[model samples]
Target chain A: MDRGTRITFLAMVALLVAAPYVLYPVFLMKVLCFALFACAFNLLVGYVGLLSFGHAAFFGSAGYVTAYTVKMWGLPPELGILLGAVTGAALGLVIGWLAIRRQGIYFAMITLALSQIVFFYAVQAPWTGGEDGIQSVPRGHLFGVVDLQRPLGMYYTVLALFLAGFLLVYRIIHSPFGQVLKAIRENEPRTVSLGYETDRYKLLAFVLSAMLAGVAGGTKSLVFQLASLTDVQWQMSGEVVLMTLVGGLGTIFGPVVGAAVIVTMQNYLAEFGSWVTIIQGFIFVVCVLTFRRGIVGEIMGRFGPKGAAPTGGGH
Target chain B: MFELLGIPPQALFGQLLIGLINGAFYAMLSLGLAVIFGLLNIINFTHGAQYMMGAFVAYLSLTHLGLAYWWALLLAPIAVGLFGILLERTMLHRLYKLDHLYGLLLTFGLALIVEGFFRNQYGSSGLPYSIPAELRGGYNLGFMFLPTYRAWVVVASVIVCFGTWFVIERTKLGAYLRAATENPTLVQAFGVNVPRMVTLTYGFGVALAAFAGVMAAPIYQVSPLMGANLIIVVFAVVVIGGMGSILGAIVTGFGLGVIEGLTKVFYPEASNTVIFVIMAIVLTIKPAGLFGRAT
Candidate 1:
């Protein structure tokens, strides 16, 4: 809402609008999907003070839903994506309900376990095609109007979706409900004493986060025209966490930057095979040990919000 | 000729025994995890990698050091435990003052690095580690056949689990450890070296995982990816048992293993997920876990 921050966000948007012409469309779309995923993840970890380690369950499952609907049922891309988002929210409800029973570290562990359960289901479920995943998923017509097979057509759709998601998150962050959520994050017991049901607020935030991540995953399946077990795996969950952490835990623009940095790194390092895992681990160690503030968070510390902490401000 | 639920006794017992063996490793690994968490106040995420290290060390000892099964039983845990000490003193020691979750994140990174390096050198295919000559072959209990090595795993794990319980629940050293876990500063004021105790607790916990890994090498293929899959299940077990109580971990580990084995008989598809389903129910009914004290 600050003038400087608004201007910065506008400039970033302007750049994104123009980037498809300069860069590869597929790569940019990939970045957009991940940026959105990281943003959804940050909504919980950064704002709600809940570290969920199994977000890929939502993201990956969304991809599967979209892919299955579009490919098997011949649904249009828009419908498929919507179904995916709904699936993510529903899965989120079940998972968030279970996960919110615990706080802090236990919350993370529960989500991870629940996600593992989902992963096992994905592996064994016939519809998911197991390891091969749902492949060659037709891009389908965009609501039976726009042909998404055209790279530019898909790029614009993704851009429009990304901006909508970005603005929705912005609105949520500034809303009164968001303020209540922040209070719960800062002090749940005190928030409850203030006549607020902290658990409901936390659950709502978790669902919203899962829904948006589902959107990203569903969109990603469209872009790539496939959905696979790789999307549902624990490592995918870890990658999203890393993206959010590296960019900035609580900042609005942090996840976007973090996702871009990570996706770019993966693209270039695709040649190195397992070195990717080692390098990611190295970054995690360095980030945890030396710079928990992260790239966006550190900058925000010096120049942006005064009391805003990257994670929940605590001892 | 006897059958129950359309499955022969031999088939059911075979699956149950296999489950018991798997549960043995789970019990040992989770016991180590509970010990470390109780003292260090951080979950050891690198445990899977440490378990993998145990098997790798065993393989290396046989091929390079010219040592055999018995020696690996003695040496691998020591070697891996020392490595755990080095890790604790160097990297993990610094994070004690921060949120314990940071310790989890740090160990996760460590797990990735350890698994990655092994993958680079060994590749993904599991290497063969034959059962020791003395333990080779089987015992016919008339109704069913039991592999001796598998039987040894179950017995050894039970004894080890019991030995750990006796030490912590009965002895003076364990009393000190419990005291330090409750109030390290007060224990330190009482002239105990709480810092040293913390370090050793972590090492011992890690050593327990490595020991289980050594035991697992012959039964399961010695592969880099082996620990990664098993560790997640152990984590689920830890969660179900609640991290606070040692006995909860052991009981849940073995019991879940049996339940999972029986699921394999009735509904093979659900076996991998049955423990998780039970975990979900446990969380709903008793979020503090079977033995964990409610906060």
Candidate 2:
């Protein structure tokens, strides 16, 4: 990462830290969680070159687990989030194993189908509380020290998690394994011929992505103090896709920008009701047709690939 | 008068009839998807929207033009097919050289637009489209009353599916189409206008969806949201059936529909998701789908 990128990221983080004092902390928290969700989804599609249409399985499942643990079993907030992450990892392993068998469109279809099953399970399973979901989840204490009932305190906690997750993703992307993933993305057969077990790497990446997505979902449920049916819907899956696509798939920090824009848009557009879906659809069409590189990608392209290690992959 | 496994035979056969009716729609729709995928190498995500359009068009024809069910059935596909043809000729034709996923994404966007627009105009609630007077009644088949319209839908879809199979598997035109799919450049050298053929193929495939929509209008409410969810299920069906063979799509569509219907009778809660459950199991055992060859 360059000085400019680093400085910009820090500024963004600072803004997020101060936002709760100025703006609504709960709303900001929602955006942060969604941004993290979008970022994790971006890791798979943008970096690993796998487009999964069923990420809600992880996101929603984690939310349910977090809610259940906190509300029913009386787990602390941090542990509830951890439980959610584990749920995501477990699902990712099974789904990744099955999905990696197919390539391209078929892989997408498999993920979608698997997630649909998860959706159905959530609907019927009594633990999910059916349509009612787990409501009024206690935020509890973080690390048994920081009181999370205060909006500002909760906001900082989420911001800390976001920053940690974001930094870890950045480190992963710059690491050696990340390079291999890029290779696999650019050309899988050639990578396989080069003696790398591409599927294993892909599966691992899938699991990590799922776990992070789960963290986001889990965090969001805590912030709202509820885990509901909306999280697992196919529409939620589509929303993540739209965010990543609009922000520029594969670009670092793009999902954050994309998620922020979308969340804000949805927040303001909520009053318009179904028109929100209509407008989002319009954005998808426009982005696919004219701006496939996305907002960050387009700007990054204008500056050239400067101050970065070359891995031979271009947008 | 008879009972099987303590369940009345009439209820059992009635469900079977409903299963067949559903299977007919599935067969027609999946056949369309398979045909489009074969030629264009693109999943037509807008297919469901076009199916919805077909129903809406038929409804419009009946309400506005005072057209009968038979005439609406004949006209709706043509109208929707022409719309699809225009779409292919314009936007979709440009993405032929790029990645196939772009086609899927573009069509998905188009689906959103179509479905959204309909929702805006017509609202989410379905409009009732009654069965034609000619086919309004039922047949007493000893065990159950099978609606004539339902039976007609099944027979018509069977004929359409099989006729498409025959034309594609055993005809001169089909040979050209297949050859083009294999190698468009080589087929072009043989004096075939491959691009035009692709456009027509897309139109034909979309028309098949519209045809199914017309058949479905009376059975289900003619609503804009009707096709949106069904298309995803059909995608699962296509994956499971392996889009590799026309016959595979037909058989799988019908089979899964019957399985779903049976699940509804035995375990009502699972009926909504049994097809997806079956898809997951299929993926675990046969990654390329039941009939799909490894790409």
Q: Highest TM-score: give the candidate number.
A: 1
List candidate 1 segments past 4 Å from native.
Answer: A308-314
Among incorrect, acceptable, medium and high, the docking class of model 2 is: medium
Clash pairs detected, candidate 1: none
Q: Model 1 reaches what TM-score against the true structure?
A: 0.98
lDDT of each: 0.90, 0.88
Docking class of 1: medium
The superposed Cα distance between candidate 2 and the true structure at residue A245, in angstroms, equals 0.4
lDDT of 1 by residue, A125-196 (tens): 999999899999999788788899999999999988888888888888889999988787778999999999
Q: Top model by lDDT, which number?
A: 1
Q: Which residue pairs come into collision in candidate 2?
A: none
Q: Candidate 1, residues B118-211: lDDT per residue as tens digits?
A: 9989999999998999999999999899999999999999999999988998999999999988999999999999889999999999999999
lDDT of 2 by residue, A95-122 (tens): 8998999887777777887888889899
* TM-score, per-candidate, Cα-based: 0.98, 0.96
Model 2 spans with C-alpha error above 4 angstroms: A306-315
**Global lDDT for candidate 2?**
0.88
